[model samples]
Target: MSAANRSGADNQPGVLVTGASGFVGRYLLRRLQTEPVTVSTLQRPRHDLLQPASLTELCQGVDTVYHLAAYAHVNQAQIKTLYATNVDGTINLLSAAVAAGVRRLVYVSSILADPAFDQPRTAYGEAKQRAESLLQAAHQAGDIEVVIVRPVNVYGVGMKGNLMTLLRLLRKGVMPPLPRFTQPFSLIGVEDLCQALVLAAQCSVGDNAPIYALTDGEHYDIKSLEQAMRTALGRSQPAWATPKAVFYLGALTLEIAGRLLPINNSPGLRSYHALARNYAVDDTASQRDLGYNPRSTFYCTLPAIISAMDAGSAGADTSDTDNTQ
Candidate 1:
């Protein structure tokens, strides 16, 4: 067996990291290495959830599974692919882990599962909600020991999606064309999320308190974020607030345009959701249960992320694959 496949090591009390090549997964893999635990990653082809082969070989002796794989992008055009990967794929993982006698499973979900939001719903949210429901049912049925963590926008270096777009806008001494609004955004750093995952897997929390919302414990104010980005870039750009209607109209127009064309990379009109809803997650449960104390506030983390981006830009060419889901 390859060294990476050693993660689901015969109930060796280590972690099996799915989506290890993605942004948060990369950070999680690195963070797990610092701890006194064996780490294994699920490889592609035969182990892929969509693949026909069973997960027997890959999950043979794994004790715990950190499931981070899914169609993370909110604007993916192929609706069928989204459900296939997120829903069916989750079943595949859960069933295989059960067959392998895994002790615990950590399913990473997104806060966008909030159904009350008025924004045009995306398939990504539907997919995650389905996955959560399946896992919850399995846990209740005594089929799997499952823990669910719903995180807000996760930020980290070398990450992709809207976060990167905002960073690029700031790097050029410009703020994102965001409207003036008061909806609070909940965000978490990749490092802190990894910590939360491990804690959720190993903590002595009861089954009733399994679902926890992950955040940095600070309310995200877009206007404040604008100022922080400017400060980080060392630019004295005058901060002017755009009217909410402008943002609304622009988003509506894009939403219409996206339907008419192939809006692949950025989620055109879906960007409005970032400006429209209250994404502030009550992290009291996470703090009380998992001891997930994030010391990095938006202001502090922004500067550090900006500095790291600057250094990376100087050393080598880099790209961020953005996902706001």
Candidate 2:
């Protein structure tokens, strides 16, 4: 990534972004350009997983620093790593920002900090909450303008999370057996989330007075969301509503086996637990304060994604068509 410099008279601030390679980071980086702000990214070195010193130097003279980097794997074994990256790393970054006289520290937290879940029981949620507390403490002590933004169940193109796995299953015509969750779950497109972040970075209304929870306008239950996906794909598939007890048992078994075996941890399981108990948020504050207007809902966007996937599959099928008859 090339650095694009701006004159001091431009009025836009120099912004530093951590987790520049992550799903949300990519969108935020692209969206920041439209605001005509000077953007710089921080990436960990190939061998060095932790780079607090490097982050410090990067924040020097920057007006706002957006901390998005974290060891996001949500499992028991990954607990230490998550704390190191999400908690310790945040502390390091905040210390550096304060030293460098950075104006604002916009933290991209998760909805897991909502207290809606028993965060103590979940490793990932607990880590996020811890990080939030650290930032809030820093804010209270007058270290920096720490603005926390909590987003729920973000999904879009190039998404590498649970939603992508579900989409992949749909592509393969396998309707995933889901839990019978009747909660009004919220979501925001990656694009809209980026917009909110930029607005948060530039906002001077609160002086860290409020912590915002962000979401798209529409909320859907698991059953309805699955049906929407099926309708989008124009396919009919049977989906089983696995009992919650059975589902948790399977997740527990997998969690145990994932340690002994070489299986990758599934964020889907954690998300399922969160949804099974309802994880909705009130984003009205973000909308009013940060000018955060969510884009199209799952019902609107899922169809487009499915239609594009279908078109791609159809094109691939006809790629070998012969005209030499």
Best by lDDT: 1
Lowest summed lDDT window (length 10), candidate 1: 314-323
TM-score of candidate 2 against the unseen true structure: 0.83
Tens digit per residue, CA lDDT, model 1, 4-79:
5663334347678888777787778888877666787877764787763546666666678888887654334667
lDDT of prediction 2: 0.67
lDDT of 1 at 6: 64
In order of appearance, the predictions have TM-scores of 0.89, 0.83
lDDT of each: 0.72, 0.67
Write the residue-wise lDDT of candidate 2 on 1-325 in tens digits. Answer: 3332222334567888777667777667778777666777764462122565665567766898888776664445566777787777778888878989998888887776656644325555567788788888877778788888888777665555556566768768865567777877677787878888888887764434368887887777777777667667666746567788887787777656656654444433454565676656678989998887787676767765666565663121110000000
**Quick one: how many clashes does candidate 1 have?**
7
Q: What count of clashes does model 2 give?
A: 0
